[model samples]
Target: MKHISIIVPEGQSNLGTVACIVGAYEIFTRANDYWKEKGKKQLLTVELAGVSKNTDFHEGLLTVKPHTHISAIGKTHLILIPSLAHDYQTAVEGNQLLLDWMVKQYKEGAEIASMCSGAFMLASAGLLDGKKCSTHWSAADTFRTLFPKVNLQPDKLITDEKGIYTNGGGYSFLNLVLYLVEKYYDRQTAIFCSKIFQIEIDRQSQSAFIIFTGQKQHGDEMVQQAQAYIESNLHEKISVEELSSRFAVGRRNFDRRFIKATGNTPVEYLQRVKMEAAKKAFETTRKTINEVMYEVGYSDVKAFREVFRKITGMSPLEYRGKYNKEAA
Candidate 1:
């Protein structure tokens, strides 16, 4: 059996971490039982290893015990890093032992997978540098600020690169585990697990579920004004030149500052702002797709639909049908 270590971050606090650990362990071990039922050998041996024998979370509301300490672990086939709750940096910094252990394990030929915000730890270990990784869409701005080298794809539900894997936020880690099952076991086994766990398999994008909120954490006054303008004028065409002039800034400098502050160019930010407004219209109104399209400033049907899908991973009608309670 391949040894699998789920390294619970030492003393890191998070509700999702507990769920990710329990959910992942249950799914993988149940897969092993399925294999034995079919007269095959067990596939994996899972261990909840940590830096110490015991760790507490959430002001000691929950305590986790490691099957093996980081100091005791030799080599393993796979390691999973669980997500954090509120504080990302503190959790990443607190678990220095696991961070070092991850680097050593990968160098010792172990594959790694991080669920949601656990990408912080993996990135901290220097594994995600020059690699495409996914995290919770809500955490994208903070993640980008910390690890500019890692290609952060928050729209993706899962990403696998060079033996490292990442998944988008929340319980979607189930889908990532199912993907791993298909790769490590077989398609049939993966299908069985998906059916057993009720996780959607092969889901490549989280766009349909994303609520497009502009990244505004940076303290750039001019960019904030530009963003507010774009948001307030979602029904009108926003010209970058007009914004720059109104804000008393040059066009070239405006573009550079906007990109640096918001992590999006002027055009992309404007498009996202419009799309978010259009999304609200789709979710709350009885308007037709074209009617909503016109409300969001797109005169051409093709242009509106293309931009809608580019931002939302679905056509206007599809998004409306899926989310608009009245339509449903």
Candidate 2:
């Protein structure tokens, strides 16, 4: 049987962390049970392992006790890092021993998976350097600032590279679990579990769920000005050259600073801002696609549709149909 170790990180647990750990454990163990019920041998040994014996959360209102300490688990076929606390830096810093253990396990041929902000711990351990990863869209800027080497794809629902896997934010970790089930077991098994849990399977992108609030914490006054200008002039056709000139910076220099500060080029940032506004309009008002497009300063319907789909993984009509209740 393949032994799967789900690392219960040593920190206060948030709802996302608790849900991911419990959900993964339940799904995988249930999969094993289903396999056994079919007259087949049990295929997995799932256990909660940790650096410490137990971790408490919600001011000690809740506690998680692991089946074994990491020291006792000599080897594991897979290791899953659950979502971490919101204070990501502290979460990663507090779990040093656990992170080191994960590194050792990976080196010994164990595939590792991280859920949501758990990617922070993996990146902190240097396991995700130069590898493609996905995490909560809200953490994209911070992740990039902390681990610039990791290819962070906040729009993707899941990312698989080498033997490591990562999934996007929140309850979307269920999709990653399904992906793993299919990869480790079979398509039929995965479909069975998905139906049992009532989770939508094969969800490939979390882009539609992302709320783009612009990364302005990098302290670039000029970039902040540029972002403010873009947000303020959403109805105007603003050019990067015009922005650079308004900020009195060279085009190349402006582009470099903007990317460094916001993790997006000038044009990309503008599109995201515009799309966010469009999304809001669709969610709250009875506006037609063309009305919202013109409101956001897109003159070319084809260009607007292409950018919207690229950023949101859905075309304008599709996005509206999904989000707007009153749209005809």
Candidate 3:
């Protein structure tokens, strides 16, 4: 049986912590039972491994007991990290031991999977360096600020590469778990579990659900002004040259500073600002696709659709249908 260690990192836990842990156990064990019922051997041995000997009582509430502490764990095939409560920085600091243990286990032939905010822990351990990762869209800015080396794909629902996996926000860890089920078990079992849980199978991107609130946390006054100008003039065709001249910064220097401060180039930032405006139009106004596109300063229909699809993973009408109740 393959060993799966569900990590219970020490912290004032999120409300979903227990549910995420138990839910994974339920799915994997049920999958094993299904395999045996189909006349095969049971496939997994699961355990909740804690960082310390103490039984954890998070938020002065739920009491979580561990099956074994990490020191006792000699071999584990997979390590599952559930979401930590509240602040990512604070939660990670308290779980330093767990992070070190995770890195060690990962080096010893274990694949690591972090659910939601738990990606912060894996990132803290340096396992996420130079790897693509997904996290809660709300925490994307903070995550980027903290771990700039790790490639943050905030628009994705899941990211799996080189044995490290991270998922987007909330209980969507179910989708990540289901994906792992397909890899370790089979597609048949994954589809069966999806049907049983009513999960949307193979959901790859979280972009449609993400509201593009522009990132301006970096301490660059000119870059901040540039961002503000882009947002303010979404209905106008704004150019990099215009922004650089207006801000009194050179073009090459402006591009470098803009990318460093905002993680997006001048043109990409403008496009995003326009797309965000278009999204708001679709979500609120009963405008036609072309009307919305025009409202966001796009004159060409093909250009508008292509950019919208690129940013949102859906076409204009499709986005409207998905999000706009009035459009429905």
Candidate 4:
């Protein structure tokens, strides 16, 4: 039987973390039951292993007790890290012992997987260096700044490389669990679990759910001004050349500074700002596709649709239909 240790990290006893831990336990246990019902041997031994015996959350409203301590676990085939609290720095600092155990487990040939912001823990433990990772879109900027060596793909729903795996923001971890089920068991079992859990399987991108509020916390006054200009003048055709001149910076220097400050080129930032506005308009107003397109300063329908689809993983009409209940 394959041994799976789900690390119940200290100082991360929030509701989401608990849900993921319990959810994973249920899924794997149920998968084993399904296997056994078919006259097959039990395939997995899933346990909650942690550095601490118990962790409390919400001022003692909730407490999680692990099945075993990390030190007691000898060798496991997989280690699962649940979503951590949003105070990522504190979460990482407080769980140093757990992180060290995870690193040691990985070194001993254990595959690791992190859910949502749990990627922060994996990255801090040096398990994700120079590897492709996916986290919540809201945490992308912080993750990029903290782990510049890791390739961050916020748009992706899940990432798998070598023996490490990561999945995007909240609830999307269900999809990753289903993916793992398929890998550890078989396609039929994965499909069965997906149906039982009511989780959509094979979801490949979180792009459609991401609200691209451009990264503006880089402390660059000029970049902040540029972002403000883009947001305030979404109806205008703003050019990077014009922005550079208006900001009294050379075009090349402007592009370089913009990328450094915002993790996006000047043009990319403008498009994201415009697209974000268009998304809001689609959600709240009964604007026609062309009306929204023209309002965002895109005169060409083809260009607008292509860019919208590329950034959002959905066509303009599809996005509107999905978000605007009246449109449906």
Candidate 5:
């Protein structure tokens, strides 16, 4: 059987730890069972290591140990470094024994995967040198400063090069597992897995991959003004003409600069901002999706639902239903 070992460090976030377990169950047991019967051997084994405090409640359900030696690391086809503490400075000075074990495993041909800040651990292992990797955008600066040898592609939800895969921040961990399913099984199988998990699979192009999550900051005065204008007037109708006049820039210059600054045009950026706000309202308040949509500048329920789904990969109703049910 192909053994996939998920290695979670101590002091991991509760959310991240739960996400790892969900990935294991969804990819290995629920999804791999079908693939195994079809002539493939796949198994998932979770191994935990570290001296930090065990803040992950879900880890109690798994048979994880305090230390994972080289012998235990042997025989796994894939090794996942789950998301770790947000302190990038501490990650730069991570555990040496774990780093050495990872090196040994990589040398023995184990595919390495990292979710979110887990890239910090992989980079510390020196395995990501000269290879394109990604992490949550908030950690992009810290990652770059700490691991200059690694070619960090900040925009990807996940980047798969050779046997190494790294994911961007948030729940893109789910997307990473889905990518693995497609690789091992087929596109149809991946689609089935997505449906089972209620995950929306948005097949992305290269340009689209570069477009989301890793946009460069625009320090231009006009661009910043435009952004401020949009945020201050999110509930109001924001027009390009208003933005151009507010920023004292021509319409053509404003359009080009807006895209250059935030990676999306003014309208797209405004809609994304609105959707983000609407998401927060739906989760934190009892307001309906339609009410939140209108509050965020969207007057049309159909268009509001479409935009939320397009950006977040989930409709406002779906997001609310998922999170609200859990919150309750």
Candidate 6:
């Protein structure tokens, strides 16, 4: 069985642990049917191996044994490092033993991945040199200041350079996991995992931070009113002219202002909101694609499928098949 090792940072923290447990659980559950179909002995196994937090013997969230199966550095197929506490002001004091182990593992061709602040640890390990990576926007400045060699793209949800993958923030970690599942298994498995986890698999292209940040800037009274209107009546026909009329602004002016504030056209923003709502129903409810289409304001099946594919890169039928297979 292929093993994915999630290396917890030196500090006695639970952030990475939380991400690994949830991500691994969803991955296995969704891939269960696929494994059975292929007659594989077992699906991928995830192991969380915590490293020492200095020599002071600081007890961590889980009880530490002197010897738990320390990963065969050269044998692990995938190694993941979730967000860690490292910044310009606070240097991440790492153990030499852990660094050497990681270097040996990388040399053996293990796919290394990081999430959120975890990029800092990977950067310090010399794995991110000359590589474009993403991290939590709040930590972007500090990471750049600390490691000038790593090209940081704070806007991306995640970046994959060769076998090394890094992503920004907590939610983006889910996007990274979905990407991995898609890479290792298939797009269908990733879709199944997203449904099992109640996540919007189609939202892989959208950055949660960017969406929320744009919403903060759109808190203007008129824009807020329009947003409220759209949220309350997502299924209703919402046109630029309708919003302009409701907000008492000229069509051109409202369109320009909304686009400027939200970084997407008014219709695009509305579609994003509607897509999120529809994705929730797709994951949680036993609705047919046509039913979901009409429920999400797309009366035409072709149009709905086209938009869903454009946003998520998967067809509605493929999505349903993945979930249905898992249910079996």
**Model 4 lDDT vs. the true structure?**
0.91
> Candidate 4 lDDT, tens digit per residue, 1-328?
8999988888844788988898899998888889898899998899999877788876788888999998888899999999988899999999998888888988989999999999999999888998999999999999989998898999999999999999999988889998999999999899999999999989999999998888877889998998898899999998999999999999999999999888889988888888988999999999899999999999999999988998899998999899999976
For candidate 4, the per-residue lDDT at 324 reads 92
Off by over 4 Å in 2: none
Q: Estimate each model's TM-score.
A: 0.94, 0.97, 0.95, 0.96, 0.58, 0.56
Model 2 local distance difference test score = 0.91
- Tens digit per residue, CA lDDT, model 1, 1-328: 6889997886556778988888888999888889889999888888898877777777888888878887777888999988886688888888898888889889989999999899998997788999999999988999999998999889999998889999999889999989988888899999999998888889999887777788888899889988888888778877889889999999999999998898889998888888988899888889988888788788899999998899888998888988888975
In candidate 3 the C-alpha lDDT for residue 326 amounts to 82
Q: Cα lDDT for residue 27, model 4?
A: 92
- Evaluate model 3: give its lDDT: 0.87
How many backbone overlaps does candidate 2 show?
Answer: 0
Question: By descending lDDT, how would the candidates be arranged?
Answer: 2, 4, 1, 3, 5, 6
Runs with alpha carbons beyond 4 Å of true place in candidate 5 = 12-14, 36-70, 92-94, 202-328
Worst lDDT window (10 residues) for model 4? Answer: 7-16
lDDT of 1: 0.88
Cα lDDT tens digits for candidate 2, 1-328: 7999988887745867878889999999888988888889888899999877777877777788899999999889999999988799998888889888889989999999999999999999999999999999999988999999999989999999989999999999999999999988889899999999999999999999999999988889989988998999999999999999998999999999999999999999999999999999888888888899999999999999999999999998888889877874
Relative to the true structure, candidate 1 reaches a TM of 0.94
Better of 2 and 6 by lDDT: 2
Task: Give per-candidate clash totals.
Answer: 0, 0, 0, 0, 0, 0
User: Least accurate stretch of 10 residues (summed lDDT) in model 6?
Assistant: 52-61
lDDT of 5 by residue, 104-219 (tens): 87888889888878899888878899899988777775677677788876656778887999988767777787887787568877888888887768543121222233233546
Ranking by TM-score: 2, 4, 3, 1, 5, 6
Candidate models: Cα lDDT each: 0.88, 0.91, 0.87, 0.91, 0.69, 0.67
- For model 3, residues 119-199, the per-residue Cα lDDT tens digits are 988998889999999998888888889999999999899999999999998879999999999988899999988998888
Model 4 TM-score is 0.96
